[model samples]
Target: MHPSLTIRRENGDMVKDMPRVKLALVIDDSRVVRKVARRILEDLDFEVAEAGDGAEGLAWCRTEMPDAVLLDWNMPVMDGLEFLQRLRQEPGGDAPRVVFCSVENDLDRVRSALDAGADEYIMKPFDGDIVASKLTLAGVL
Candidate 1:
C-alpha cells in the first residue's frame, strides 16, 4: 500500500492541515518506467509530472521548478547526461534535486552523472522503497 501525504518537520512534529504538496518530475522514455516513478512520487505526497524525453523534460523545467526530478540516463532527443549538463546551467535548475534512474550502473557513467550534477543515481529495476529512500536522502521525501 502507499503512504499518506502528511508531512512532518525535521523536529518530528506533524505539519498542520493541508500541507503544501511537493512537485516531482519524472523524465523517462519508457512509459512503464514513468508510470512507476509517478506512482511512487505520488505516494510520497508529491504532485507529479512526466516527460517522454530529455527535450520535453527540459521544457517542463522552464515553467515550474519541481522539488525533485527522476531522470533517465538515455532518451530519444536529449540524453540524461546532456540534459544534466544543460540543466545545471539554467536559472533555478540547480535548486531541484535530480535523481538519475538508469541502467548505467558502471562506475564511470555513475561518476560522470554525479560530476555533471545528478544528486543521486539508481540502477534499473528499482522498487518504491529505493525510490523513497533516495528522495529522503535528497531531502525530497
Candidate 2:
C-alpha cells in the first residue's frame, strides 16, 4: 500500500489546510519507516505525502510538486537513482529539494546520491531529531 493512503486515512484532519507547512513526499517501502517519518514531519508542521516505491514517488512528484522529497535508495520499482534522474529532467524540476534516506552506508553510494541531486542523505534507524536537523541544513525545514 502507498504510504500516502495510509497517512490520509490515519491523519486526515492534520493534512488539511496546512499551507504554512511545506509539502514533502516520503518514498519508502517500509510502513514502519514511513510512520516514523510522518510523525517527525507532522510534529514539525509539514504537510506530508508518501509513496511505497520510487515509481509511485516520481509520479507523486510530478503531480503534487512537493517542496521536498525523502526518498529511499532501494525499492522494488524504479529505484531512487532512476527516480532522481527522471525528476531532474522534468520541467521546473529543480524546485523540490531531495534527501536520500537509506540503510546503505557505503561512502560511494552516498556520493552517488549527492551527484544524482540529493541535497542530503540520512541513514536508516535514524533519530527524528537528526532527520529534522538534516532537513533544516538542506533548507527544507
lDDT of 2 by residue, 95-138 (tens): 88898999999999999999989999998879888888889989
TM-score of 2: 0.87
Hey, what RMSD does candidate 1 come out at?
A: 7.8
Candidate 1 per-residue lDDT, tens place, 81-139, comes to: 88888888999879889999999889899998988898998998899999989988877
Best candidate according to TM-score: 2
Q: What is the TM-score of each candidate against the true structure?
A: 0.85, 0.87
Query: Candidate 2: which stretches are off by over 4 Å?
Result: 1-9, 12-18
lDDT on C-alpha atoms for all candidate structures? 0.84, 0.82
lDDT of 2 at 122: 92
User: Residue 48 lDDT in model 2?
Assistant: 80
For residue 97, what is the lDDT in candidate 1? 93
